[model samples]
Target: MTSIVTIARLGAQADGIADAPGGQIFVPFTLPGERVNVAVSGKKADIVALLDPSPLRVTPPCRHFGDCGGCSIQHLEQQAYRDWKRQNLIDALRARGIEIEVDALVECPPHSRRRAALTARKTEKGLLLGFNAALSHRIVDLEECPVMLPSIVEQLDMLRGLGLLVAQTKEPFRMAVTQSASGLDVATDDSGALEGPARQAAVEYCIANGIARLSVDGEIIVEPKKPVIMIDGVAVIPPPGAFLQAVENAEHVMAKLVVEHLRKAKRVADLFSGIGTFALRLARQSEVHAAEGDAPALAALDRGFRYGDGLKRVTIEKRDLFRRPLTYKELDLKFDGLVFDPPRAGAEDQARQIARSTVQRVAAVSCNPITLARDLSILIEGGYVLKRVVPVDQFLWSSHLETVALLEKPKKRR
Candidate 1:
């Protein structure tokens, strides 16, 4: 049934929420204070007509904005869009009962995302490669993507050809492509099992197209050139399908915040350090001990540290922090500064351990504000003061955000 409802606000998922007699209804692609006629079905609604448009609503740049699942909130005006994202962080912190002044949102420009995991499938007519539809498994073929680097988007046909060559099963698979210094590094996961002929075709395709590296299900198929990502003048070769910051500019912003905050410390420990994005930069001044669960990533960090010139002492440890977070007893007040950049789940166990320690300075980098706030709350409860929080818009037009939070513990009383 079609119903007209006034949008109350944008929810956590960037969907317009409307209060009705039954319950709250979520309408996608609508804005607050706007009246929209939607076809309702069990708390989910599709916009049948836009009755009253919001002043903050702007025409989305991409033609595939609503169809493609890669971006959200592209319709919001620039200033309003930024404020909405910044408010997301504030709301999350407030939910945790921790109130503090959040720094302004750092906006990453369009066509800045260097890494993307796109879905691919072989239809009866031809090969389909692009992001999946929002809340659906169906793939939306991309004519143009405003969020991804043009270099990556320009090679869509090439990627599709490669996908057609590698994909063996009828089901959909994932192709994770990253724009490295060498070239585009393509890695496939959940693709059909690679038989002998399929593997041979994949190798030939990578060599013929000059792909930097091609890996199938974490196994390297062929590497024309080592995929190297330069971090602050240091070149590091990450493992196949390794973790990397989505936006280069945002990475620099976060690193600068971390390095400046820990400038005075003589020694620092980097937890969950992936390929030493911060460790190598920090080693320029302070002695850095980088620990991470991925052995290959740690090895890569150590290699970069060893080869790089004019850096302080840098060490590495391959330890699973989730299983055995560096304990307070283990920490033993050894380091004055610490920097941790964990995954989306947000290092809860590690945060608890860090809270009980005597670390004077800390820089917490997270992609999820809710978990970041939760971790910050734990630190604050343990006597650490929340110094500053900066929301970074790395994944532009999407609900995802990155934050760099600096915290400090006061000196002990005599």
Candidate 2:
């Protein structure tokens, strides 16, 4: 049935939500205040006609905006788009009973995403390669992706050719590509067995195309050059399919915030430090102890620290922080400051320890606002003062935000 409804707000997935008589309806590629005539089914609706269009809705830049799931809010005006993104952080914190001021959302421009996980499939006709469609398994064959680096987008044909070379199954597999300092680093998963002639072909194609490295299922196929990503002039080789900040500019912004915030500390504990993005930079001023679970990442960080000169004493420990977070007794009085950048599930256990410890300064970097708010509340309850929260737009046009928060504990009142 076709029904008209005015969008009340944007949901967490950036979908427009309308308060209907039954309940709420979600419409993709829509904006608030727009009266849309939608074909209703269950709780989902498809816009058949626009009775009224929102002023904030503008022309999306990319032709693949609606089809490609990589970006969501491209149709929104720039200022309004940013406000909505920033409000996510504010609202998340407020829900945790901590009303704090949040900085403006950091701008991430087009062609800035350094890493992407794309889908590839081989059929009887030919090879198919691109990002998966929104909430679907179907892959949208890419002529171009505005969010990725031009170098990566321009070489789509070459990637497709390479995909044809290594595709072992008819079902779609994954290829994670990252733009490194040397060249493009590509890694694929579920690429069955490539041996003898097939292996030789894959290796030759990568070398011929000047790919920095190519790996399948965590096994290196060809490494013409070690994939290097420079962090504050310190070049660190990232392990195969390792996690690094998605955008270079956003990483630098977060790192600068961390480094400046903990500059005065003589000793700093860098927790969940992957490839020493912040630890290596922080070592220029402070003695650093970086801990992480990934052995390869920690090894690469160790190599970077050992080779780099003019940095203070730097150390690395391979440990699962989630399983065994540093306790308050272990953290107390050992470091003046601490910096932690955990995965999407924010550091709850570690935050509890930091709350109880005597660490004077803390910088918490997070990609999820709800979990960040939960962890920050723990610290706030333990007497740590929430100073400033800056939201970085690493994942542009998406619901995700990278935030760097600075907190401090006052000295004894006596």
Candidate 3:
């Protein structure tokens, strides 16, 4: 049944929430204080009509805005959008009792995302290629995605050709296409096996299109050129399907904050350092000891350093930080400052270890706010003074925010 309700607030995922009869209703595409006529079913809602629209709502840039699921808040105005993203970070820090003022949201441009994580499936009609719809398995076949680099969007036809030739499963599979300095690096997962004549056709397609590399199920089919991503003028070739920051602009912004914070330190330890995104850049000034579990990533980091000139001495360690965090003893005298950018789980065990260490400056770079808050709280409990944090909106229109937080552990009594 359709019902009129006033949105109370935005949920963590940017869904509009309303107090309903039993508990609450979540409606997408609605902003707080907007009275919407929604079709209510259980705890879910679909906008039948907007009884009252929030002034914050504006005309979304793309025609696929509501359906693509690549962006959530495109309808929101620019300043209000920035404020909402920044407020989320502030609220997360406040929950941890670290009430320092967070810097304004570092707004990334619409077409700056270098990485596009999409879903694709082959249908009788043709091949479906795009991101999955929000909170559903259904794919929204994209005509255009404003958030991704035009370099990637322009090559979608080529990607679709590969999908048509190689896709063996009717079910949707992951299609990750990253625009690197070299060319478009493509990887697919769970798309069934590619063998026989289909494989040959796919290879031919990549060669003809000047695709840098193509990998399916982590196995490289062809690497025409080394997929190199420039890190502040330094070149680093990552392994196939490796994880890097999604936005180049955001990566640079975060790196600047980290490097400046640890500039005074002669030596720095970079933990969870994948492909030396920060460690390689940090080596421009400070000697860096980079630790990460991915062997290929570490090797890439080492190679990038050796090939590039004028960097300080750099070392690499291959260890799972999640399983075996660096102990306080190892961390104490090894480095003057430390920077860690872990996966979404947020390095709790590692954070606890860092809290016990005597490292003077700590830079915590995280993508998830909840886990970041928890980890920051642990450091605070160990007497680290929370300085300030800057929120980076690399994932434009999405709920995700990249944050850089600086902390300091006071010197012990002499």
Candidate 4:
């Protein structure tokens, strides 16, 4: 069915929304108050014609803006985009019956994304490597990516050539590329088994092309140079496909908040501490015990701490927090400060334990607002007062939002 409709507002996913005869319809690449003739089907609308354009819409920077899944809110005006992001945090917290003043969205500039996970496949026609298209599995073969660092974008062709040489099947695979102090750290997965000659060619490609390191299926094929990332002042060699803050600016901003919040404490417990992003910095002042499930990530953190100079005692533990959250007794034993940066699901089970702990101060970092809200509500019920909440736009021009929340549990007087 084709009909014209006026977009009322933007939804949580950065798509323009309309209240139709059905429940609701989502139309991508369209802004609020734009009357667009769309092909409607099953609560989704594809804009056939722009009958009216919204004043808030602006010219997008990237040529592949609409086709690429990398960004969604790039067309929206700057101030509007910031408000919409901050409002997302507010709304999420409100849904959990918790109300607080959310700080303004901290903006990140374009061309600063230091990490990217791209799709790749060797096709009969040619090589296809780039981000997946919006709402589809097709790869948008990118000529230029405005959101990623030029360091990564400049080597796309070289990367595709390597992909073609190592590809074992026609089906798609994944390539995770991270920019480090030395050079690019490339990891390929689901590309099938690379036999003897093919693996040799991929290794030669990395060495000849000045690529720092290349790993296939979690195995390092060639490491012409060690891939190192300097966090605060310590250097770390991240494991294959390790988690990193997408943008450098956002990582520094979030780190500053976390470090300052727990600065006064003598002992700190960092749960889900990946690669010691915060623990290494925190160790400059406090005795830190970092726990995580990924053994490789924990090993990297331990190495960074052991080699870092002018730092306090920092210990690493490999523990699956989702399965066994640290109990309140364990936390209260020696730690006065706590920090946990969990995945998108948030740390519900761990938050329950923190609620019962006597850890004086805490810094909660999350990429999902709804899950963060749920955890914060849990901490509040356990007598923790939410002191500050700062929303960071780590994933720029996308639906995702990152938040740094500070909370303090009061001391019992004798």
Q: What would the TM-scores of all predictions be?
A: 0.98, 0.98, 0.97, 0.99
Quality of model 2 by C-alpha lDDT: 0.92
State the lDDT of candidate 1 residue by residue for 343-402, as single tens digits.
989989999999999999999999999899999999999889999999999989988999
Predicted candidate 2 versus true structure: per-residue lDDT over 1-414, tens digit per residue: 999999999987899999999999999989999999999999999889988999898999888888988888899999999999999899999999988879988898989899999998997767778888888999888888878999899999999989888987888999999999999999999978778898999999999999999999989999999888998888898889999899999998998999999999999999999999999999999999999999999999999998898999998889899999988887885899999999999899999999999899999999999999999999999999999999999898999889999999998787
User: What's the distance in Å from true for residue 201, model 4?
Assistant: 1.0
- The global C-alpha lDDT for each of the candidates, from Candidate 1 onward, is 0.93, 0.92, 0.91, 0.93
Q: How close is candidate 2 to the true structure, as a TM-score?
A: 0.98
Provide the lDDT at 347 for model 2.
91
Worst 10 residues of 1 by lDDT: 327-336
lDDT of 4 by residue, 1-414 (tens): 899989998998998999887778999989889999999989898989999999888999999998999898889999999999999899999999988988888888889999999999899977899999998999999899888999999999988998898789899999999999999999999998987999898988889998888888999888999899998899999998899999999999999999999999999999999999999999999999999999999999999998999999998889999999999999999899999999999999999999999999999999999999999999999999999999999898999999999999999898
Evaluate model 4: give its lDDT: 0.93
lDDT of 1: 0.93
In the predicted model 4, the residue pairs found to clash are: none
